[model samples]
Target: MSPAFNLETCARPNILALEPYRCARDDYKDDGSNVLLDANENAYGPPLADAVSLTSAAADAGLDLLGLHRYPDPHQGDLKEQLCALRNTHAHTAQTLTPANLFVGVGSDEAVDALLRCFCVPGRDRILVCPPTYGMYGVSAQVNDVGLVKVPLTPAPEFGIDVPAVLAALDAAVAAPDYDVKVVYLCSPGNPTGAALRKDDIAAVLGHATFNGIVVVDEAYVDFVADQRTASLAEWVLEWPNLVVMQTLSKAFGMAGIRLGAAFCAAPVARLLNALKAPYNIASPTSTLARSVLGPAGLAAMQANRAKLVAQRERLIEALPQIPGVGRLRGGTDSNFLLYEMLNSSGEPDNAVALAVYTKLAEQRGVVVRFRGKEHGCLGCLRITVGTEDEVSRFLEALAKTLAEVRQ
Candidate 1:
């Protein structure tokens, strides 16, 4: 069947109506030369730092490499081959991921945008996403004119996944006659909540989508989970064509600056994404850096970082709750970020208290954190990205002082 769903009937009417931006053929294919023609990239030296070296705290991390004079591989062939081994999910069972099954974007953020562009019709079509999760999901949906149906995560049992509620949303969307559940976005080890979706919950959603639709499991933070191997749904996508597992090199591999990310799915889904994506979605340097990072040494380093982050997270779990006014600290079993709720001024549950604490940390302690607000079951909550031991200690010290001030 052709992928031509209703452009108007789906979401992002604005996107469908507007002419898509097109790139010339030369923009994507690189013949490997000193001079470049294609996307009018600034004829200049590479940045100050290498992809790996860029992560260090050093100020001048970019290195001006001369290879900037060429186009990147539009298909991302090498990167996909490496990802296949890393993901442990070969395309044809025996192998062959090929350029057909993969599309590389600036980052996973771009992958999410591409997914919306391909599947969502905008303005007419609708998507279902859980809140207290990634805001980008909603933003990307809106950008594509796709309507969002939010079923927020429940905050009470420590921001537990409201599986029944999500299922109900799906059922309602399907029954509405006007809407079909085009995509279900689940963030395991959800942001702010710092808890992974129960495997059963994932299975149920995948089953539902397999029978009647599509579900995209985003494992962006999966590497931080204690059991990283099980935190992803990459393998399942092979069994369920409707499943699209999205991942990025940003979190674990520490390649956020390079902006490289990938989506794993059946060839058909990959085709749709490719057709919708810009010809040269990934930069040449980005691919080169990604290739270097996805090798054995890079993967090992990522695993080591994950191990260190997990250890630090566990340390926080034990040390954070001891501070007064901290109602709870939730983490582990999935994800590197942590969620800490603060006791209200009235000694009751309060997201405001948490917000105030986050503010104090940034303003007074000069510590930055992403506040999830009360929207996604993280009422009175703060999402702290795990850092080095020294950084964590600094945070804890400031946090202790902040809590003391708040309590009094």
Candidate 2:
């Protein structure tokens, strides 16, 4: 009946997009631009600059670590501007993602929860997930007291979403009296499965006629994917208003401890999230470190590290299947991790062996891998994260020994 889908129409009515609480530090964003007496910060600066140890990058950024007395910028204008430029470098068919298209948070988890709170009314609205994916999506749903509908991804080795099943679930939920599906969470280069979803498949969901809820694509490991500038769906925010692309610095920027993440979406959706978040969700140190690492040198460093990881990943892929008890690799070659099944006496996947292999390696040898044999279609599989050259070599030796010990 209407011309097109509107995000507001699908969102919870009570959850209005109110203006964010303005902070005194916000006005003094430009360094040495104003007197800055409004926030009542100590003009004396920190007494113990000696207590801090600055990294080369941080020192190069020339941030005022002494300015810890003042609150952080609620708008995060500068950081968002840099991130927008990074994303815009990949824009071709889609328009540029400005500061308006971004929402920064404490890891991607905050954005996930924010999306749930902004749209779904707890107990009345539900969300959908393609299983054998990230567990945080379900954790966030439960935390918000919202319901979930799970449509498992395809069988082992491909873990792609069942598009028909997803649409069918949405259509069925619509006819029900009390169930309204509000959001869909998908992991690209999926967590344990490690496969990137085909672009066309995502397009199909975005173009769905009956389902109006937004779709979120978590690209936590996007930096590890080949040709990331082309593979990322971040630029899709301009083309698909109902789409949200989540990314993080933890995986590639080597800043997991920093706990910073970003969500790129339609400018309106982004503004809505900004309005809903706390007055100052990001801390001064976090923003400073983020700015330091988002520059040209940081990107080059990350890419060089990525190249090492990719080479190690290929090393594992070629060698893992050759082991006596190891079966074929189960997922695509996109992520920093790989999933492979352990073989039983008859050469079929065997959970007992997989668990034994996982236990023996971690306990006796200090090698740790996730035992994901129970996840859908991941029978007897163990997920291994790509580590440093020495770590990978050590893991390979340890894994072969563990498998031999377990099989015996």
Candidate 3:
């Protein structure tokens, strides 16, 4: 029989079919500093940096030491406590959604694996992915032994969410006798494509998944969204209990090196994800640095960087059409990247030609950009991230030269 909840109905019976991972309070709790015998850390590792150096050093000096002598917090208490303030959730009565409702991983990548491990059963469960989106979703699902259902977005429709197709897929899953759909994943300000799913579209998916399954909204690029319109289904997790909002500090915060991302969901979902994560997922230095970046001053600087990137993105879009062989510019409603197609004399789509142009600019002109072909629904396109004014100018110069050479 199909389960009562849509998420459960879509999951592997043996997986969502079972209780979530649970750890004893004492098991997760921290007990002072010395004699860390909990998770079997290396007896000796890198030495810790001085407090003074850690506090006011330049970026290079700040990241100098590892000090992996002791295992960092498994539950990530201090980091979560700090992020709670930054996220600014509603007031709680008994216990304001503690660190338990939060799971910090090496990056959003680990969190993706943890979530799949928690719910997916090998060879029985499947995940649905929208094309021209982040590839990690499909990759993680496959690595975890879960099936993948491809639902390509209609490029003709501005690559908007295929509401009807998604709804039909849900209907089909519900009709199946034994199949269970656990989670539906969506990426906003989606990668490569840079298309931001609308609020209404996200709400529709959330509402549909609420009764039967879980909806995971990946807001990895939310920080780059113009006007900050990216969905915050984080709070919805409190009310709906079936929503999981994942975010990363890699992009806007310029903390990609620190490698930290978070998953915000109801306490139950968070607990399950937390339990499935590695005991010591975060490093001591990473936790400390993440905390520092989430502070008021650091956050302001991050926002300023985002604004600069957006401006650069606009400039690129405006300039692309003027260049011959470039058909039309796409993407960048939200996010720092933009995509545009380059056509050959025959009017045929040729991403390889575009990639060659990209390489020439990078190798000969010293300008680097991402080359994302039409494989994931982005035919004959180039994905370029916004850089500084000087960098953008250099890119335009390099691009013009490459186009002239390609024409010849």
Candidate 4:
């Protein structure tokens, strides 16, 4: 006879002790939704004209329009092919990438989760992260029952990864008898920090002989980075088998609703992730829309939108410093957002003041931005996304009013 499963006893201990990730929407749910500058989603929606053109082309190409009833392609070959073409155009590499090198997921979050599941065994395995970075890496680790080793970024060097610290941490973990560090998560054009980790620094981590683990670089905002050279390190996957580059259509392509993310890695790792993920995770409509957006016309529209957003980002960088009580804008201006401190009467980062501004802006002024004071090294900081010109103006005006009112 087969043994009966006890739900409580069978549940993993680490997962049992996990605190779930608090999404932005969860905190600010239905307080009369206004300017959604939180969550770092692109304010601009997807390229409708391009989508229309592509859909028409797709119909003409005899694609099954009623395929919504069916499951999405398990491999998502068409989307992967388009992604490969896109990557090849931007950064040419001698080694060609096939659909075999790609793994498509519902979003980058899924990729993150899948990567952990594929590589790290529950409770015993560990992952390294540079904090004041993406929250999801830690959250995913917790959910998967994987130990997280944090080597915090040096606050001085614009939140760059501390290579030596990372090495030491990895070595220490390796020397320990129980835990095995299986994955290292690096967020390029980092979430709240907006800093791109140097390629050389990343290469050093990848080359670390002692820590034989997969290095997952989350380039969720790579397209927003002005410098193309520093923006993407996907091509490096060809050279480093242990490297995995994750990107999303949500940020740059303005397809958050569609929920498509790409993972570029060596074939074996890709296969493992594919094996671990739900067979029909990416829905048919989502795949269809994703493929349409990844088409040539859609790519052109995305580029145009990117150019506009970058211009808007530059404008914000120029204007934000002039606002009263706004202090140092920390981190590199590589992504669409800016991380700056809110100073109090003493010109120091005042958590209370920052919280007041954040609350007042959302509650009273109908403008929303992230309050990241609790993050490592991000004292009294607000991470604001680069919105439309009008939105930016509104935010600035709202900020000025909120600061004055709070001070009064």
Candidate 5:
């Protein structure tokens, strides 16, 4: 059994103890009943669009001109309500999420940084990251002026977390002289790997009796998983106060530009994040677009889109290995992306050929795939995002051509 977790003790003594800046929006509801002079917003609404009436198409897609002059709902109560409702449908827990359980940020990056800053004292404390995972976690660690503890995922085929090594590291630092691990950042359907971590492995880390740190599980591409309800650990947050599950509309909803991401955790943690963030971090337009996408109609649209990508991703998995220079499809096919290797003459992974294929595909054929040959255990690999049928077809064709040329 794990030791009892305490947010008060885990947080940086001085930094995380915060009193939130209550804005105008926080004082009163904007329920169209009382409008007024509080937040310094312009009384005159934003200038009307030139000669363009609100079209049926705009209304149908839930697109609109937001009140640009006024500040966005700082609490974002409505958007959080929609998000909680959506996650609750897939959640296995009886504990339903409320607005208090979520902290909306500009992107998942903001949450990552906030977690690091609130918990980790720069230069003295650190965060743990499994490499061949998201780059942003490490980037955020550095940007926060905190140190990083790296325990790479067990090599390719599985690319699973090395829980033993992680526990050992955490245990070793428990009574260390300096620099304790304050957070553990995990990526499910891992950024480049496209691999989902096993639930038990994560649970082991969370249940570590000696380690008293936040375990952040980034489920950014969770929707792309074949069975997201089973794959997501979102519901686990209800049971584990130290857990924070991050999700975004960027992957499945196809709304990356909206710059909205959420951290679903216990209420106290959520409160800490809310207090720590900018007063108006999520813009009105961003909030509007997010609400539209997360609504019932937009959700249906997203499901339809996700179905198409899953089909295409499966097709690539089957067909990609047939090419002369292509090797095994690395990791799990748990995301809208695939990580596969480029083969050399002797049929081993080849970084030179992989780089060439990546460069030629973008420069000559107008297809783009990420080259991540330098990452640990990812030799001669390209991370290809699953695109539309035509786009995937073009990528496969372009890849085959490029590989043949590079090999020769």
Candidate 6:
């Protein structure tokens, strides 16, 4: 008595039109020999001493071999407990966070996807984003059939969010009554931008009288920031129930391969994300490695590595502008990368010159950096990840040579 469903028509139209997120490896297939400064991965691998210590401890605790046969804990209580303790170090108030405030996922990408699913209804709800930021926010919105309202950051203030403009956009959406703005994504220590949004500006958005939606701040590169208070807003979750702060172990912990991310939010939102995620979302092997890196010894080693990377970032800032065809550096120096313009013979942004340098660096010199000229406000730009001392030296050499060849 039942009619058969047509799979093609059943598929959401928005998803049908969506293009997949192009990861670094998708564009350039690394044979493991190239100097990769394209993606914002830490050139220095995880701390060996702490890794060894963790392996020994896991072995003694009988957890080293357990992952092969058993499913990972659905609750991921142990890892959550460790994160809770670590986060309390910068607690905004005397109040401490518990596992109820946390949601663990494969990565922040999953958290972003889950939040949209939990809040936005297909073709009915909308989300707000500031441009020249993370690509995942827009990509996830497209996949979910949600409308995106963009209020680009004011270029004058060095890529700072235009809080008043965002408020006005939300009001306009409400007056029209066309779509409900269910979520707002903010990336601090932003990708490509390499800037941190001021705390007061973020609070202004969270405290908006008209917008009752959740504000998710992606702090993936927060670990690279020298000041912990400026770098993180996780503690603010207590004061602002609508706030959610997302972080990852991929950057500072050098565990991109592990694919673990954490979100700190109010209990209700955390519960919803958990409900929407796959039952066994975090794999056993991934959880084991995550726990090891989050343990006491591992935390200390991570801090040591962070100190080194921060130094390298500063060194790059000092030396990069000296190169030929390099123009003004944009945004704040909070993250592990820099976004600077590549100029031409006449000293203006030249996309052609930038592209040629990018191609030559990768193809001829085996040094790959990202060409971001196409992004909003990023004309003739190349976003380079801060690498090891040797890598930086090599990058400078290759860049100088490439610039000369391209200009000629």
What is candidate 1's lDDT per residue for 65-129, written digit by digit as tens? 44455445566777788887777734224443454566677888988888777666557667788
lDDT of 3: 0.71
* Candidate 6: count of backbone clashes, pairs at least 3 residues apart or interchain: 0
Clashes of each: 31, 0, 15, 0, 0, 0
The models' CA-based lDDT, in order, is 0.71, 0.86, 0.71, 0.80, 0.86, 0.80
lDDT (Cα, tens digit) per residue for candidate 6, span 1-408: 002212133223443344434445556666758777865645664344457777677678545542233334578888898877777755465577889899999898999998888777789889999998899999999998999999998792289889889989877876776777878899998888989888888888877776657889999998887777546777667767788899999898899997999999877667667766676789877887888889988889999888888888888888888888888887678888888888999999888988999999999999999998888888999889888888988999999889988877
Best candidate, lDDT: 5
Please say which candidate is ahead in lDDT: 2 or 4.
2
Q: Candidate 2 on 302-405: residue-level lDDT in tens?
A: 88998999999999998898889999899988889999999987898999999999999999999999999998888999999999999999999999898888
Each candidate structure's TM-score, on Cα atoms with residue i matched to residue i, is: 0.83, 0.94, 0.85, 0.83, 0.95, 0.84
Kindly list the per-residue Cα lDDT of model 5 for residues 1-408, writing each as its tens digit. 347467878988765667888866676767877867887877876665552465334546555553467777778999999988888854557777888899999888788888888899888998999998888888888888898889999988899989999999898778788878889998997988888998889989999998888999999999988776676777668888899999987888898988999999988889888888888999877888899888888899999999999999889998998899999888788899999999988899999989999999999999989999999889999999999999998999999999999988
Q: Single out the weakest 10-residue window by summed lDDT for candidate 6.
A: 1-10
Q: Judge candidate 6 at residue 126 and give its lDDT.
A: 91
TM-score of model 3 (CA atoms): 0.85
- List all candidate RMSDs to the true structure: 5.2, 2.3, 4.3, 12.4, 1.9, 12.4
Q: What is the Cα-based TM-score of model 4?
A: 0.83
Quick one: best TM-score, which candidate? 5
Model 3 segments more than 4 A misplaced: 1-67, 89-98, 209-211, 229-231, 346-349
Q: Which ten residues in a row have the lowest lDDT in candidate 5?
A: 50-59
Q: Model 5 — TM-score against the truth?
A: 0.95
Residue 86 displacement in candidate 2 (angstroms): 1.9
Q: Which stretches of candidate 5 lie over 4 Å from their true place?
A: 1-4, 31-35, 48-66, 89-91
